[model samples]
Target: MNIPKQRIKISLAMVMPALVSLSILMTMSIMFYIQYKNEKRSLYNNTMSLNLSSAQKMAVTIEALFSGMRQSLRASANNPAIEASAASDQKELQVIFDLMLQSSPYFNSVFWADQAGTIRVVSPVGNNLNQDRLKTEGTTEALQERKSYISAPYRTPAGRWIVLASEPIFDSSGKYHGMIGGTIYLEENNILHRIFGSGAGNGKESYSYIVDSGGRLLYHLDKSRVGENVSSNVVVKRLMGGESGMQRVMNTHGDDYLAGYASVTMNGWGIVMQTSVSSILADVDRNLEEQLRSMLFPIVLMLVIAAYTAARIAAPFTRLYKLTKSVAAGQTVSSEEFRPHWNREADQLNHIMRAAAESLAKQTLSLQQEAVTDPLTGLSNRRELERCLDSWEALRDPYAVLMLDIDHFKSVNDTYGHQTGDQVLKLVAAVMSDDVPKGAVCSRFGGEEFVILLRKHSMDEAYRLAERIRNAILISKTPYLLPLTVSIGVSLYPEHGRSREDVFQAADMALYRAKNEGRNRTIAGVKSA
Candidate 1:
């Protein structure tokens, strides 16, 4: 009953295209039907992913900006020069304020006010800020709390919408001295606008905005909306309530939008990323009827075309889906994963995701560095030193700890001003940094004080190194012509004392005795066995 082989092959080939083409057409029809039914929901999910990513990115960056401002203020308040120079001695305070502004880009203005809330010194002056009294939320809260604070948004008497980050300055003997405040203008080209502004204005009806706890707009794509109150908006209300999510909602203007929102952890502010529903759904506007009209070729040809078309549409959606998953899971995706997919919508999605991830990575790195680095001296900060101590302690390693204090440092501040005194700190920091071996830490412990940890070094080796550091400081020259000296106290871990704190305490006691004995000498602490 079998037909001849050649005839059978030809018959089967002819029947195959008809069957495949029919199946392809049926599949296309079903896909189009499903798309028509769920297209809005599907598209909304995709756009919401993008919106959420942007909101999270903006919030992280703003939080970092706020953290940097706080760090700068804390460093300023800790400076002894700041404590020494008060009222009518703006020379020293002015110098420190200028340094604060120069070191950090987060502040639009830096100012210092005394205990009575009088703004005494302002850097880059004449910005129309009130120089007489501190009336802003940041200063008021800092003065009340007697600690560092970042205020919510408020309006200055000069009518500037701003957030003030202020730190309470304490004098050397532990009395409340004053506060240092830095202001960030909301409506201007501040860091907020510079960071999240690029998220919108693409003519795609996609935009980003920020709001404080009060639902007052801090940043908006529509310039007019900046500084306006939008608390009544559903998104703002949810954000103020500490809820983060995405939903489709109608704006006050009666336009529908898919919005994603999150709160900034450092400040009680909310960021929103949204896009118009009409614009996104437009991509699905090419009806199945129109697609069917274009598919009237021979069966074989139709099958070929259908395969090509399905691959074209399906590949990009797959990529976008995978990208969304990665971002949601907080997994960093490679740039190579975002190669141009020959589709406009997919490429744009790829670009958005990549840019956000890259920017977030950079900001995270910067924050990590800032958290462990002394801004002025560029040495390991106290936080970093403590972290290192924890690591060494866990490893149960022995090391030498040197406590150094600049002799006559206050006199330097008094004679030449804080600017020159700052030069002295930097000079001392540099001299200590120049000769430290690998696996050692040089950190600024506090004002005019530094700590160096030398791993695997005996007390003798540490004393010699400490002496070199002390001599280097004695020979170093400050910006102003003044003699310099440093007293060093060296202690060996486990030998000097059992615990890290005990070793540090022994070093401090030795340092105290050195200062008592003379102004400039190195003392190796002894522990009774």
Candidate 2:
């Protein structure tokens, strides 16, 4: 069969460029992976910080609301009509209670109850007026104990949530006669939003709510949850115990949230500021997409360069092969066989091939470097961690994996904005990179989470490393942002589990436990025998 030179040239052009492009494409994929890791971390931090800050601000507003209610109750207790508690004083007491209800937007009702448990007067008179309060703890405590206090939130007969604040009434002889009380109808009260300055967030997924010491919701954007028990929730439990802080928690409804909580001093009630994890990170994800698009042009240009260079190198080889094949079949060949001449084409091919080889080599090196690298933090990414896991599992090399999550990182973005949040993440990344033992692999596993592989380290050594990182994070301060802290979960390979995935899961669970137990600490995974 006769072979046409044009056909050979055409095949060479198509095949060589394609082969070269394929290799370049594989390298480009790694670059894209690196880009993805960096973008995701930035986005995650921004979202988390935003949610955190929103929660904290909402917490402060809630404390102030409770404080104002307490102050109002105190002022009302000193009224002459309330202190007198006489039958003739009912008219004046009604006027005072009515004025109190009008002035306090949150007040649902106000009433004066005698020591005998008979309600003398009530403003905006309801079924409860003239009712006995012997069964009510709030009224009994104030009337008998001669003290001022706030009560746990409860649902009234009408199914509305209300909290009572009561102060003991005393006669001129300082004898406890009865009590003057005020009620706050949580769901109907617009006063909370007024004081908190609107409990809504940047999106529908963000919201705030109030819970008493028992974890029964007093107020919520979703009214259905009101009067429901949330005591099983980790954050709620902590807040009910009078602890105030922020963390990422998964609620009983199976929703993950960045929550900030604080306890109200007067009643031990909790203010919860929370937002969905997905909604908080949405803007960051969009930003990452735009970044990828911006990088597309450069990638296209590289592919073009690879193709053109491949074609030049392939042309001369195609011509040489054809000539050799013809000669082997007893055809004569001369030095000046082609229009361009063999020598001239040989020189041109050599130069083009060298240039193409150099370009390809440089790109290959770049890809290798970036394949496991997180660009923004200059650390290994999840891809690198996966690679190390595969190698360690195959070689049966013992190691420890530490999963570290930044505590309350979302609040940073909420308070200082995303730009400052980025700075906080970078600082944390730096700390992790610097603090780990030499030869350990430190990586950002996306967002405020990071992974570190400690080679041949004992469980004790791993714990120390984790503790150091945790402590460093706690002490680290970023401008315009709060101090940072990290929770670390440690799992040893072959000890925790035989497989990489098993070890990773074990570590993750331990990390979850650490966060659940209150953050800014380290916990070791349970290893199977």
Off by over 4 Å in 1: 1-31, 85-89, 136-138, 200-204, 286-529
TM-score of each: 0.49, 0.55
lDDT tens digits, residues 442-522, model 1? 999999999999888987789889888888777776687666888988898889889888999999989998999996999
RMSD of each: 24.4, 15.1
Model 2 over residues 1-529: C-alpha lDDT tens digits? 9986664345666755564455456555766677667866665565556655665666666667667777777777766655564556667766777888899765678877777878877889764543654456555565666677777776655566767777777766887767777876677755664565464654347777778889998777776677789999999999878887777888778988777777777567777777777765675567667867997898678667656755676656566446544543545445454335355545554444344445555766698889989887888988888887778778889999999998887887787788887887788899988888788888999987889999899999999989988888778877664678888899998899988888999999999999999988899999876
Q: Each prediction's Cα lDDT score?
A: 0.79, 0.74
User: Residue 108 CA error for candidate 1 (Å)?
Assistant: 0.7
TM for candidate 1 is: 0.49
Counted clashes in each candidate structure: 0, 8
After aligning candidate 1 to the native by TM-score, how far in Å is the CA of 436 from where it should be?
Answer: 84
